[model samples]
Target: MTSDTVPVPPGGEILRYAAFTTRPDGGNPAGVVLDASGLSTERMLAIAAEVGYSETAFLIPGRAEGTYTVRYFSPLLEVPFCGHATVASAVALAERAGPGHYVFATPAGEVPIEVDKDADGVLRATLTSVEPHVEEAGEADVAEALALLGWSPEDLDAALPPRIAYGGARHLVLAAATRDRLARLAYDFDGLAAYMTARDLVTLQLVWRESEDVFHVRDPFPVGGVVEDPATGAAAAAFGAYLRELGAVTVPATLTLHQGDDLGRPGLLHVELREGDARVRVSGAAVAIP
Candidate 1:
C-alpha cells in the first residue's frame, strides 16, 4: 500500500497499477485515474465500467508541466491507445510526480512517457510507440481470425506471417506454430467481437517464437471487452513493429515479450529496437496493486 498511501475511491482516485509485472499479482491490471479533469464521455465510460480493469487510464492534465490528456477506457469502448493503461499511467505518475519525462496526449498519437527508478527501487515505465504500420492481414481477415480462434491454416507461423500491427492500437499479428498453439485460448467471444468490430481490431497478438530474442505472447482481447490481456502494452508496441517489419528483429533489437504465462499472469515485455528509430520502445515493471 505504498505509492504514498494511494486509495481514495468514491468519485476520484482509481490508481491500482500492475502493468508489466514485478509482482502485485504479475501484470496488466491498470485503472489509474490521476485527475480525469472533467471526465464525461459518459462519465469516462462509467469509470471504465466501474473499474473492471482491462484498461482504465484517464489523466487529462496537459497544458505543460509533464503533460497528460490521456484517455483509454475499455470495459467495452473508448480506446485509441492503451498498453497496460500506459504502463499503469506511468507508474501512477511516478508515484505522484517524481520520476522523469511524461507527455501522453493519446487518441492514438504523441505518446512519449519515461518514468525511471529501477535498481530494485522499481517504478519502470517507457512507452514511446505511435507511428507504426504493418498491414497485410486480409486473406478474408486471416480466414475470419482463424475461424474465431479455433485456429487453422495449419496452426500458422510460417515464420510469423499474418500482420496487422500498428503501435498504438490495432493488433492481430498471430504467429503460434506451437507453445501448444499459443496456449490454447478458446475464442469465439461473440464471434471475435463481431470480427473486431468490422476491422478496427484491438487485440489478437497471440505469438510464440521462443528464440531469436525470445517471445511468447497472447492477447485476444475480444475487442476490449476483455477475455485475455495480461500485459499487452499496446500489443507489445505492435509486436515491436511486427518484428521489425518481419525481418524478425535485427536493428538495435531488444525483444523479450513473454506475456502472462498462459493466463497465470506472468508478464514481462521489454521490446526495444533503436538504430534509426521507427518508434516502438515499450519497457515494463509497474507494481502497486494492493
Candidate 2:
C-alpha cells in the first residue's frame, strides 16, 4: 500500500490565514502548512480537508532558500494552483525566513513569489503569474454559463463581451453593466459544476468595471463546492490578461479589483501588466485569521 492512503483531520492541525487584505476578516481565507516535508499527497489532502478552506497551501521545502514545492487542495478536491494560498504561504514563510523572493514548483507550473515588508514592516506577498491566455467563449458555452448563473446576455455589458480566461486555471469572464447586477448572484450549482467540469473551468468571473483601472468582481466556484469566492487573485490576473488581449487596457497599467463585499469579507487585488511581458502580477497581504 502507498503512504498516500490515510486522510488527515480537517481543521485544527492546520493554520488559517486571509490573503490579499490586511484585516483578518477581509481577503480570501487560505490554509497554510509551514512544514510538509514528510507529508504525502494523501496526508496533505487530509490536512486540507481538516483546514476546511476553499484552498489550503502545503509548503514542502522546510527551509526558505531553495525552490519549495506547494500543493493546493479544497475541502472536496485538489487544484492545479491556488493564488490566495500561494500568497498566504509566501507571507507565512517570509515571517519566519525573512522577506525575499522564493520560487514555488506547483502542479500547474513554477510560480515565483516575493514577500516584502511594507513601510510599517508588515510582510506582504506578491506572486508573478505564469503566462496567461484568453479565449473567446462560444455561443453554447456562454448560454450554458448564463443559464447556470440565472443571468442572461442582456445582463452582460455590451462592450466587455465574454471570454474564457486562464492564468493557472480556466475561468469564464463575464462583465455586468452595473455593480447592482454583479452583486445579486444566484446560480444552479450542479449545472454550473457540470458545465465547468466539461470545460475545465475553475470559476466564473462576474465583474463590473467601476472605472478604467478599478473593477468590482465576484466569482462562483461551483466545481469546488464553493458558492462564491470573495477574492480571487488568479481570476483577477486572468482578467487582466483578458483586458490586455482585447485592448481594453494598456500594458504597465495598475488595475485594482475589489471583491467579496457582498459576503462582508471585502478583499482587494492589485493586478499589474508589465510593459514587455504578457504575464500578470498579483499583489496582496496575508492576515492571520486566528
Indicate which candidate wins on lDDT.
2
User: Taking the candidates one at a time, how many backbone clashes does each contain?
Assistant: 2, 5
lDDT of candidate 2 vs native? 0.85
lDDT of all the models against the reference?
Answer: 0.84, 0.85
Best by TM-score: 2
Q: Give per-residue lDDT, candidate 2, residue 211.
A: 89
User: Which pairs clash inside model 2?
Assistant: 8-46, 10-49, 10-50, 10-51, 11-50
Mind giving the per-residue lDDT tens digits that candidate 1 earns over 1-290? 22234333334577788888889898788888888776677777766777778878888787899888888878789989987888878887888878999889889978988889978788888988988988888798898889888899999889889989989888889898889978888988989988888888888888889899988888878777889888888888888988898888788988888888888889898989898888989998788877
lDDT of 2 by residue, 154-177 (tens): 899988989999998888999998
List the candidates' TM-scores in order: 0.35, 0.94
